[model samples]
Target chain A: MHFSPILLHIPDGFLSTIVSLISWAITIAILSVAVKRTEKLDEKQVPLMGIMAAFIFAAQMINFPVAGGTSGHLLGGVLAAILLGPWAGMLVMTAVIGVQGLLLQDGGLLVMGANILNMGLLTAAIGFGLYKVGDGRKRTLKLGLAGLGAWLSVMAGALTTSLQLWLSGTARLDIVLPAMLGVHAVIGIGETLITVSALAFIFRTRPDLLDPAEGPARGGRGWIFVGAAISLFVLILSPLASSNPDGLERVAGDLGFLAQGKDAPFSILPDYTLPFLGEGAFSTIAAGIIGALVVAILVFFIIQSLRTAKKNA
Target chain B: MHSNIFDRYLHNNSSIHRLAPQVKVVIAILFIFSNALLPDGDWLSFAISWAVILLLNWLARLNLGYTLKRSLIVLPFTLAAITALFSVPGKTLTIWQIGSLELILTDAGLIRFLSIIVRSWLSVQIAILLVATTKFPDLIHALEHLRLPKMLVTVIAFLYRYMSVLTDEVIRLMRARQARSAVLPGRNGGGSLLWRARTAGNMVGQLFLRSYERSDRIYHAMLSRGYSGHLRTLNQHELNINDWLIIALAFLLIAFLQLFAHSIG
Candidate 1:
């Protein structure tokens, strides 16, 4: 429901089915592990997780004017990760992304896995790791590092999205990769400022809101240096990146992805759904069920094998 | 701008509304998956999928105009796909030069772009229809039945319940800020951008504390009532014969269409 002018989610049909399915598998695997890690959710933590998710959701709606009369909203992945642990943060994000897709149609159901992996998994996992790098140091340093982590997290998500699109043959990596990384590099600055200032407020008002180990410190020189470096990088890169906006409109009038799809003889569906209906009344339906069962069993075995492999290692 | 335009579940007695929530979830996913898998430029398949979606909308007694408007949320994504026009290398149909930069239009690229747009538009429509018919909590329930993690489901359920409460709290906080300050921060006429942002950050911090306290109280209340970690809802999702038939028919429809498209190709 929070529609920021800056958008980067890869919608359905943009990625090939194979890429999307693989993303789904990876996402499910990570989330299931996350579920295991957080299995014994303290009775107190459940409501905290819910309310934090809601708070993040509500905070996203309150957009601030950035520059040139345009506005931006918080992604909250790093913020949630800093406030909560990384695993719980990922869960909060997963729920947020799921709700956005299912209720608001912000992203497609077919591509939810990819969306979650890009915006949720990458941002939290990498952002949190970078955040802890400055841990056991100054509080100002920690906040500055949080800002840097938030910024880099957005860039990482953009990079992953570009890679997926390139793999899907939607766009050439040379063109879209730079365009995406450049745009997100600018947007990540906004992410950084919001995250740092919010953390600063918690540092001032409710120090206990943050984890206890990150003690308050005095100097903010590290914060100033990091912030300046980010701005310098964006100022140098964004203007050179302006050509991409017109690239889409200028290149071709209109082309169909399925133009060549119709000429191809092979279809992946038949291999999955056998033509068993030729024999009996319900054979087609039976074949469909059998195919579904086969897929389920295949997935179960794969997961089992993975568990065993992990145990052995 | 915060409105209930999203939770637009209408009160109507229609077959689409009557279907179990899980069935609807399955149907929507299957429909989207099938549409995404459809061959690019396969106009026949696109038309059939659109027709089936429209028929469901009619069955649900939803306003066509509203549904269409809601589906336009996919436009920004379509803009992203437009990049494919320039980046996809193929046989050139037209060539142009912009500032010593060569740009070429390829038949294959254009078709790929259009197919992506069409497929995404269709998928959005199906998704919108699914949400419009079912209650939000019921959708979460369906996800639980589908074996999504219990903790994840519980988090989502609480989010749905508290989203409105927290939104109202934010509205109140903003109103207080506006009343105290001479100019509304961050708008057209306001204080410096950084000052306004700090104020907003403080507001967020305050909201988090308030929500945290409220959750503590809520948890205590639940404990007084012998609350456990798990939340239980009365079982109301009993699948019927019609549900099975609908599932079968939907799968068959998808299979038949894919098979038909293949044979013709």
Candidate 2:
């Protein structure tokens, strides 16, 4: 019923040192890129970005009761990305999370890197990637994509948080992953509703703000493609990281990939193996990379064919 | 509007308040890191860390009770670690059968869970002290001096400056909504859940528009005052011998605690 204000912020000592440090490395690298990208911003837009950060910080304080006494609030990552572009959105989210950690103690300083990565970087990337798909599209379609992006960003955040906890040995992957996803699945709907409604309001009122040219530096669609690739890579690797086979097997069964008691017809990465590396963590990671790469290339070709067909038509 | 409720900075002229912001920032971070790195169930090391924190609190002229109470904010989140009680493998302390499932509380799990609580509490105490002792602007300056990206630092500065203003705006919006939506004694106040969420979303959208317009006006005002892209602060803090001595002492204490934690294991 009573929701902790900063529920998603991973506090200190929850994450293992290795996971924390690795998250820090990834966050620092991405933030450096974000900083460089937003470096050429117009002098006027700087204040806008700052106030937007404040707006997000303030927006998160607003909670709408979901069911029972429980409530859910806007995370504002996707909303920010839609208003500002991804780079600026990430910067705004970072500043908000930073203040939440340093001043509010909502998240830990040591694991602040992981918190920022999970809640800010990944959310912004996923949210913006999906939302940008609707660029110049019909109004309803754009709103639909924004809602979907908002929902998925929450899921991505929950997924990464589960992975971090699992990797840190704080919780078993089999238990934490499904539990987190299930709860966030509901919370994410709230995110979707709020983001879509808010975006709809903006669209109706000041349509100029939604225009990419008038916004902060627009991230190229190339960022979307790269984000998609990275997400696919992580998703492919996740199941292998879980020690329990039933988790993946059950998923396979539900997806109709595993028939009754039959073995899968074929295993591209059988037992997550590589011929050169044999069976170990490294082999599993290598196989995941190969699988992700194969899927990405296939999708690329399909899109390429569709584009060419449209041109010919 | 009681906007400063979120800003816990207490006006005091203690030595900790006068210490270099960067020095305090570095020490707080190092202290937290040392605490986090301690092995689970290392009560001795945790005790020593608490002692150090208490001593610092005394020096800062802060009410120990106030800081401890503030640090209790971490308690609810400790629920996230509850699953560790059953999911972790160890010697079973207790076992309960619920329907088709067996929930086992392991000794190792209990130790780890308690350690997480203590570690978070200790770290949060340090954070509360840091924020309470240092001004927000000075904190931002410290971050900039530490070589954080200028643009990011500037945004953080703006965020701190405008946080209260936006917070007041949000409070006003909520008050308006509450006034319109009246509840019976036993039932809900607002419309259907979807409507309520939409209303909140609309409020958010309204807030965004206001914030965007305010930023424009703020920029124009700055420009009128001959504002440049760069922000110059009045205070230029150079680390004095006392600040260096404190840093050295903090480093040694943290190193010693870490060494003690490792030695025990």
Candidate 3:
């Protein structure tokens, strides 16, 4: 009857009906989108996806020695995201979580929705997002990012769990939140190393398995070129600029200006007017709108190109 | 591979087992929700709920001792809830100065902690009852009927079916590792921590490749037989008037008991 501390599966009565119901609503919304998208997958991927779910389940059974004589198992959100795409990976995690709750009694049935959201949807989404942080070509970079992604995914899950417990009045946020984060930060290191090693091994052996949904690596060069061009333009033309005196100054001072700076306060400039016209809230909004539009357009083209690339492949 | 750990489904011809899987799932959720919604420290409600759960267990023909033993799985969760005993601020019943910090236990905290434990125990008991009486696949079919995403259900079905196979594969891999390396008989028997981890990582990589290739072959085989994306099977669910009556009677009783407990408490 002893359960490992590393499991983090919330049992019943920990969450109120309101929290559980809201979680179920959000989980169902995401899962419905996942189902709709995956429905368009090739029929050949049917067995592959199923077997991948089994692989995750089996992988979890293998326990590795963590710090202090205790053992821990893989959550496999990042692994699934790397092997499959995020959508499919989320589905696989959902299935794994569901089966664990239903059969193994690892989690409570009432709280299954929250568990899935924390361990499945959020982890897969965040991990996949971090995995895509680096370019897909370099082996070392991909593996490194995968490790980071895996580590962050665990922390994110832990954070979400603590927040949910706090919201449910199960525990005080001041006590449980710090405790959960501190414990999970160390646990996340083990996750990172395991994920890195596994990904490196797979990349060395069969890189084809690493991003199945990404299809072939066509137009990547073109996309990089486009990205560089956009970056150059943004760097030169951006009005939000504050140069740091030195590395020491930047470290001692705020890092807020490292990205976009604070917008102007007043509405002297119209929203469409460039920042050069006036230094007001309207210009800041205009600048923000312009930046968002550019990014959206770029993402749209990248996706379109990837779809065509997949067709070619 | 320890497939025997599974097959918890008890073969019984009781009326509880005869109810549709969807009905049973709904009833289980309702029971858990009702138990959870009850006011903390309402021992009357808790007692009534336990009595009803025990009744259902009897109707299902499950062993009382086994059911009680199985319900002990909620113990770990109770430990987590126990933290509230010290952390929750209220009327201090006891306080101990340990080193630099003071650990205080309040009456309200104790009540909340105990309530959480009892509620969880009761909820898990109902869950165990549902899973113990219904077949696994039937339960999954019931989920499908409940409109869980198809992709999720499909993955669950395959994961459940192939988990044992993959576990067997893992056992073989471990056996191979053990045969090659022998050290002490206790923990960390065969290798250092990093070595064991590396071997595990390799095994995982190997398993992924194997499962991947197997999936490809399976897909090809299925395709040769005109396989498509959708999974179709014969529908065997049929609900009778007895099922409806049982479900309705159970809900009505639960409602009445809850209302009575609320009014009295």
Best by lDDT: 2
TM-score of each: 0.80, 0.86, 0.80
- How much does each candidate deviate at the interface, measured as C-alpha RMSD after superposition? 6.5, 5.9, 8.0
**Cand. 2: chain B TM-score:** 0.95
Candidate 3 stretches with Cα past 4 Å from truth are: A1-5, A211-313, B1-4, B87-89, B184-192
What does candidate 2 score on TM? 0.86
What DockQ does each prediction reach against the true complex? 0.25, 0.37, 0.29
TM-score of chain A of each: 0.67, 0.74, 0.67
lDDT of 2 by residue, B177-263 (tens): 989988899985776676787788889999999999999999999899987875789999888898889999989988987987999
Cα lDDT of model 1 by residue, B1-265, tens digit = 4565447687888989988999999989998889877887788989998999999999999999989998888887665666577555578888766543455678777888888888888888998899889998999999988889888999999888888888888878878887876755666665556556556666777777888788888789879988788678886787899888999999999999888777775
Q: Which stretches of candidate 2 lie over 4 Å from their true place?
A: A1-6, A214-216, A230-313, B184-189
- What's the best-to-worst order under DockQ? 2, 3, 1
What is the TM-score ranking, best to worst? 2, 1, 3
Candidate 1 has what TM-score?
Answer: 0.80
Residue-by-residue lDDT tens digits, candidate 3, B150-260: 667777878877777876777787678768876666655645555555566667788888888888887887788887765665766767787788779879977887788
Can you write out model 2's per-residue Cα lDDT over A1-313, one digit (the tens) per residue?
A: 1212336799887887888999999999999999988888778767888999999999987878778888878898989988999999999999999998888888888899999998899888877887777777877667766776676677678878877876676765555655665567577777877887788779878999898775348887776785575456454545354323354445434222111111111233444457588756677677656744553343344334333533675
Better of 1 and 3 by lDDT: 1
